[model samples]
Target: MSIGKEILFFFGALGAFNGFVLSLYFFFLTQKKYLSNYFLGAMLLALSIRITVTVFVYFNNDLPKTYLQIGLSACLLIGPFLYFVLQSGIHSIVKIPLQWKLHIAVWLVIIMLAGFWFPYQNYPILWNNYLVALIFFQWFSYSLLSGFENRMLLQKIISDYANAVPAEKWFGTIFLGNALLFLSYFLGFSRVPFVSCITGAIAFTFILYLIILVLMHRKRTDDLFVFNIKEKKLNQEEAFVLSQKLEKLMLEKSLFKNPNLSLNDTAKELGISTHQLSQFLNNNIGKNFTTFVNEFRINEACEIMLSNEKLTLESIGYDVGFNSKSTFFAAFKKHTGTTPLNYQIQALQT
Candidate 1:
């Protein structure tokens, strides 16, 4: 190989090599097993595998067909992992949902079935002419979808780059990097004379180093990648408005009476995310979701007991939303500093 080609190959191979090692570090060496980190690991692994193959094939015309198939198969995974990495970080998804699992399973099945039915060794023409297009399409489609889904974050970074948090800026860099890398490969695939096929690998090397620079500047890449998703904190004005709304909804809807009410359900009724609602309750109200809801139930129970001396303790418990007598008595005592029976008696005497 010429010296120029050798130098180009060195940088490209270095990027792929570092990426593979980083993927392993994320997968097994990280102290915390965050889902976002796991997705990031998978994304890096897929990109490294695809780029390694690209670099080799660009240099060697006689590379084995098996390597070609492996590279394309890894290419199919890159887009999905990219989408998942962004989403899992943004949405604070700690666990893999069933639908996400099913999505991955479906993609895996399709790739395996295709490879089994038309082995690249036996049907090189079919793989090259038709399957390659399909693979690239899938990769492009998911890349576009990922950007569309996370456009708000991108816009935030663009509008306020100076004040944007490290996590937001990190996310934006990743999205833009992926887009550029995809464009580089797409230009090569389109047979643009100016853009050589090896540009993709070179672009990837630059992108990877750029992302490393971002991590270095932040000095908190650990927190960012692990996705300690900073909940959107409410300002004083927003907090007051949400607090009032929460009280109004609770009083009007009597949501605590349902007995099956959950933090998620209450957050939905208040038109806020669960995390925001939880933060509001804990930080502003000085109570957790369970304690807050129980307070309401206990207050209502007291009102009922005072209004109607004819009701039994167990009956009053059920009337005010407690599903079990023991739970009702326990909460009543906790809030009032007396059992339900004692409180009722004290109230009647007063």
Candidate 2:
């Protein structure tokens, strides 16, 4: 093998090993509700598969033509799968429906069957791979776009948190790493295979490192045991002040129109740490960040629904920051104890 091929294989092997270990950690250590764990597992599995293919190609004197066809086809599919995993993870964090899991499972089964049954046919494998890639790519792009929207939503949430907190650095780092990884894969498929593979592996490594760091930080801070008796009293006073400020800011700014708002984003906008914002919301606001933000959104949505007789329910729900009509209705019902349409009807009757 040439020096370049040797170097590529070396990195490939390292990436595969790292991915396997990290995936195992994610699978075993993290809570199952965290969708990122599944995404990590999928990623690690894909990396392991790549490593297997690389070893086969390098050790064997004459690669089976079928292997090459299957390997390339698999690699193309893996790129989009990785993106989907990341997207799903983010959606899960925002409590959104991960409707794509079923589709992903079906596609994986089809791909595996194709690889097993007709492993050598280049056209069939390539065609299926291309079709899956197209679908995955569109979904991936939509997820990224959602992330951008979430940033704005996060800002609103932050404003409601205290107007004194700074944004967490970790989120920015993770977002950048993800973007780089996506770009690397795009470049890889655009003809520069070697560069793409090396860069993509590096990007994956960075993302894993970020996840590990977050886990470590959470562990060190004793995140789950919130009953520190000594600190509780002091924190209570601070929380009260923060909550009042945050609530006032939210009303002033009319921030309920942002659908992707998050507690972390709100904390940053307020120039406070997420922990502090979370504490304030819990102790003073008498609600979790999710509920607090949803309440505001639902209230705004009710006003819009009542005043706009010509607007459809779906349009009004979306216009006021609910990602879907169902979510809007659910949140509205939870907050006001009435369905959106019924509430509107009742308001009109009155």
Candidate 3:
């Protein structure tokens, strides 16, 4: 085999293998039965099939009509579903409501069925290209609208997992990588053969997948979601000062404006460690980072709702760093015993 062909085969096999391993890890090790798992599994399955097809095409010098058609169809059909699964998984992890899963699933099934009946020889590249384009459009449109939602949830998960540090940059990198992957696939389907784009998508997907697995694994063991109880029992005054400082930083720096800001992040910004910050909140503030941050965010949200009469509840919620309007309202009620609209009404009356 030529060098280029060898490289392609190696990377293809590597990507397929990594995807398979990660899918299995998620299936067996990860306790959370997230909808993303379904999509991940499907993606791995598709990748495995693609790898097999690539191998066969390389050796036989002839593509099986059924295999090529099915493989292309599956790849195109699976894209949106995979994207949605990733989207929904992030939401589920952060405890957000995402009702679009079923809708996406229904559409996916319809598309897959269309491909099953449609032969590649008859429709050929155009059929596959059109389907791929539609899938990209769906994924992109939903991503544009729901991207912020995912980021918000991602922020919460990172904060809960990383102690209030912004991991959105990492996740943002993953998103950009995925976008490029989609764009690459789109170009390839168009017969443009964007080699760089293809390689980048594969590489980025693999890297991000590994990063997420590591983060999730760490979060499971480290008690990231809870306060350090022993630390709370030890320090009082220092903890109080640290908590106040953390809260001040959160407010003054407009960190609450970031839906994904976490305590570990706060510690980094304040030139301290996550352990110190955790101790501070636990001992002095008597709450975890999530609650503390939510209190400030909800309060800010209330202020925005009262002041900006033209703003929608969701806009106000998003403006103050809450991921969803529901979360904003829930946190508002939890802290002040009033919904955002009610609070705004009362503020106006007063």
Candidate 4:
């Protein structure tokens, strides 16, 4: 090999090796805290193994037939692992259900059938075709599922946590990266024999390393799953009672009239956890904390704008809990579809 080619080979091997090492790190060191992390670790491990073994097969065609068989056998695992990684990452579940074990048992049975059902030589070709077809189908189906999930997760993160830009960007990148990677893999598969894409494998190794690098740097990447999820924080009766109390507090004390009134402060007044209050808002009322508070401020501003002529828009905005005139104008326009001045003029005319 030329010096440049040798260099590429070295780095490719190094990256794939690092992916393997990172898998162990994720599984043992990081995954203990979350089942999502465990599944992600397993997916990375499967990816690393498949990539490494494909490269091994490509570089060493003279190697034993059974080694190829084992390599092909491991490919059976890749799609399922990716599916679980996506599921566990998005579901926020600490424990995956036992139903998945049935899939594993069935996959093992199919793999064993490949080993013993036919003559070793003929079974290799027939069984490999079955495995490849199954792998592609599994990947395609799960890609669709994850695409839908990624969209939902993105909406949830960006909606409830406006400051979660990093999470949003990372998720968008991950989704794009996976899509591009699979497209590359599928296209490359058609051009060459199943495992002979030397250049493709090297490029894929580099890309997978980039993803793993990002995943490692962002430790709480998986927390995007539960970032805005509405946990069942209160039963119907309790939620109703709390919601009533909150409304009473807002109405009687005019709590929303405080420019800096906060969910935590309100929660304290109500003697409930901040979590319960937040859950009540999202699950019961379908509003975020900012939106809910701003609704009250905007409503108060509207009432003042209509009923009293002495107060200027700025004074009215401040009186209704807005910290700044700009915020007041923006919130007024957002809630009422017009600027405060414009709304006042329109209200007078109507």
Candidate 5:
């Protein structure tokens, strides 16, 4: 091997080896089932195996039959493991349904066929090419399915958790990083490529590793779902009663008019946990706590706008519980599609 090729192989092997180690840590050492450790660990392990196989094929010049078989099997798993990662991360679900085993069954059949179907002696090159094509195609197909699944999952997560931090952006980096790795492989492995696949994949691996490092540096255990449902499902009557009680508390007490209002305080007043309140707002009201409170504040500000012509917009904002003029302006514009001053003028003109 050339000096450059040797270095590439060394780093690539190191990265894949590290990835495998991390996967073990995620699977067995980490005790938190809520973070989707098992699925993540499996996915990482599969990716590590594929990387390892690729390294062996590139430097060695000849692919061994057993190695080819194992690599193809691992590649077959990469996509479904990604799907499992999404499932476990967003919902904290560890036990999959028995029917979902259909995906596994399909992968098994593909592996079985690929393992046995080779007419190795007469058309050796053709079999090798066919296996590579099938493996890449399978990986790409599963990637597409995972992309769709991720979109739907993100929507559901946001819709279901009022307190959910904006995680879609961070999670998107995961998909983009994977795409970079795939592009590297495509360029390196395909007939249509000018660049070396090994080099590109290795470069992308460094980039991906940095991202992983950032994700792991979080102080809290990364629970994707911000709120846990004390009870899984709520009936219509129960939802209505809880919602009504919450509304009464907000309306009667004018809770939104407290400048330092917090979700915890409101939950405490209502005799429920903060997670429960978060669930109520998300599921029943279709609003986050901030949005829910701002609605009432904006409505009160409008009433004051119409009824009291003497108050300044800034003062009226403070009266309606905003801590600062900028915050009030932003919330006013968000809710009413106009600044407070503009809304007052527009209201008078009409």
Candidate 6:
């Protein structure tokens, strides 16, 4: 083959190869086992399989029909996986829902049965002409649904790209990449003279790299995929009751005095799930657990400093539930905008 064709093949195949490795990394090697990452991994695996077949077929027209069938079968999953990636990421799903499991199971059965009934080796014409179009349309439909899932982010990206969150933009880029990839394949399927199946593979290579660049540029690789539950809305009455109960409990029991106080421990004390307590702290009080607890600690620390000027800051930090003097100083600076010594001096003068 000429150098130009060899270069095209190398670039196209490299994307699929790297994508497959990354999928495995996310699936079993990543330390954090997030559901969103699982879906993203699955989507990558599907894309790699499809793109591999496309590249091979573009270079070799006589590729086995069974390989084409397998590739197209993988194509059927790309859309659902794409949707799940967005849905799980946006919703912060911890456990895979039953509906999601069932959705995938049903699709798996459908494709398996189709392959069984109409083996592509015998029905190449139908698979190539009719089923390929169906697969592409299905993929496109999922792409649209994915857009709907992230509609707010898309609007933000379009209206105020400058201010949109890095994570949101990263996700939007993935959706746009998928759409552009579909366009490339659709053009080839339409028998556009200059476009070939390999065009989609080439486009995917560029899209894949662009996605990686966006992820790296934003420095969101860690936080973006980390599973933090979507904050739930707490109504005013419930919020008021919870806040009062929490404050009273903390004041009466001094739970924050424990240096190792945890969200789970506090939630158990409050007779609520950790999720509810987190929601209350985050939404109603506009403070995370640490900040809420630190406020009490800082208040007590200030009172102690005023009562006995001879007490050392290190002792005061431990007495006030901080695990270390440095943490106490940092939190104090963050909440009070002053060092412990400066705060004490200012208070004495006042």
Name model 6 segments beyond 4 Å from true.
Answer: 214-220, 226-229, 232-350
Off by over 4 Å in 4: 65-68, 118-131, 149-151, 154-162, 165-177, 192-349
Rate residue 58 of model 5 by lDDT: 75
The TM-scores of all predictions, comma-separated, are: 0.65, 0.48, 0.53, 0.60, 0.64, 0.65
Per-residue CA lDDT of candidate 1, range 130-164, in tens? 98899889999999999899887787578546434
lDDT of 1: 0.82
Report the lDDT tens digits of candidate 5 across residue range 58-77.
78866665675675577778
Candidate 5, residue 197: how far the Cα is off, in Å: 2.6
Q: What pairs collide in candidate 4?
A: none
- Greater lDDT among 3 and 5 belongs to 5
Using lDDT as the measure, which candidate wins? 6
Write one digit per residue (lDDT tens) for candidate 6, span 1-350.
89999999999999898789778877998667888789988998999999999889888879888888888899889999989888887677778899999999999998999999998999988887798889998999999988986787687568545433345566677778888888988898899999877888888898878766755576336555642446566888888888899999999999989998887788899999655676677667877678889999999999999999999999999998999999999999998999999999998999
Higher-ranked by lDDT: 1 or 2: 1
Per-residue alpha-carbon lDDT of model 2 for 1-350, expressed as tens digits? Answer: 78976776666566667767876875676554355555546656665565456456655648766665555455544544555544544343434355665656666787677667665555555545664366347535744764564474345444454432222233334345556655675676565735644566656655666666666666342332122212242366666677677888788876666777776677777888677776566555666777888887887777777677999888988887789988888888889998888888999999
Instruction: Please report, in order, the local distance difference test score of every candidate based on alpha carbons.
Output: 0.82, 0.60, 0.61, 0.69, 0.72, 0.84
Q: After TM-score superposition, what is the CA distance of residue 155 in candidate 5 from its true location, in Å?
A: 5.9
Please tell me which model should have the higher TM-score, number 2 or number 3: 3
TM-score of decoy 6 = 0.65
- The top-ranked prediction according to TM-score is 1
Q: How close is candidate 1 to the true structure, as a TM-score?
A: 0.65
List the candidate 3 regions with Cα displacement exceeding 4 Å.
Answer: 31-61, 76-79, 86-90, 93-101, 125-129, 151-174, 193-242, 245-350
